[model samples]
Target: NAGVTQTPKFHILKIGQSMTLQCTQDMNHNYMYWYRQDPGMGLKLIYYSVGAGITDKGEVPNGYNVSRSTTEDFPLRLELAAPSQTSVYFCASSYSGGGYGYTFGSGTRLTVV
Candidate 1:
């Protein structure tokens, strides 16, 4: 089974272009999160969802949007992509509010120039 899947493992975007990074988890976890890691930096939460139809903005939600319509899917949308948005995105999921540990996707590397 695919624990978690993220599409477009790598992408290059010209400034002002937009794209959606897709994430899906096979494990029926109640919590899902989007995190971005800058070069030589730790990951920062961009957004999260506790359940379907419930979403919350995390530490760095600016210039990005997210929607959780089902337990298995949470997609992140980049708006007016900018150089500042260049980073590697990771998607993770866990059950029981993360007490069971998380299953993370391979990650998507994005470059905005």
Candidate 2:
């Protein structure tokens, strides 16, 4: 089973263009997260969902949104995408909170002009 996967591994966006960063997991994880990593940088939390039907904003949630209606999928929506939003977005999941290292998808490198 694929642990987690992200589509369109790379993307280029013009200012104001929107895109959805796809993410999914097959490990039946209950905690899913969307994080962005700048070039040669650390991961910054964007949004997260603890379980189905539950979601919350994270450290960097501006211009982005997320939903977790099921246990497998957690897609990140980028609305009114901006140049500042250009970064490597990584979708991750963990079976336990703060105890286990998150399983991260390869990543989606987004460039906004």
Candidate 3:
């Protein structure tokens, strides 16, 4: 009840469609991140926020967006979905960056056709 939670465990999107991958946490963490893992590859950071009202881009953020309106919520938005965006999205949070381990949600598997 006090960890990360992601909605829509699986999803399929048509070309040019859009959706928001919902992520929330009850742990009151200040650091949150969105990562996408392609098949046979490691996780690539998409976006991250150090605290509420502050956000920054990560390694891969061209097709994604994120907002940290509050301490518990960090939603990932996919606008004009493309096949290249197909991947497993993971939402994670930590009390602070480094040292402390992150709590990750189950993940959202997205496929674009």
Models sorted by TM-score, best on top? 3, 1, 2
Off by over 4 Å in 1: none
C-alpha TM-scores of all predictions: 0.96, 0.95, 0.97
The alpha-carbon lDDT assigned to residue 93 of candidate 1 equals: 96
Q: 64 in model 3: Cα distance from truth in Å? A: 0.7
**Any residue pairs clashing in model 1, and if so which?**
none
Tell me model 2's lDDT, rounded to 2 decimals.
Answer: 0.92
| Residue clash pairs of candidate 3 | none
- TM-score of model 2 relative to the true fold? 0.95
lDDT of 3 by residue, 1-113 (tens): 75999999999999999999999999999999999999788999999999999999999999888889999999999999999999999999999976799999999999999
lDDT of the structure predicted as candidate 3: 0.95
Candidate 2 stretches with Cα past 4 Å from truth are: none
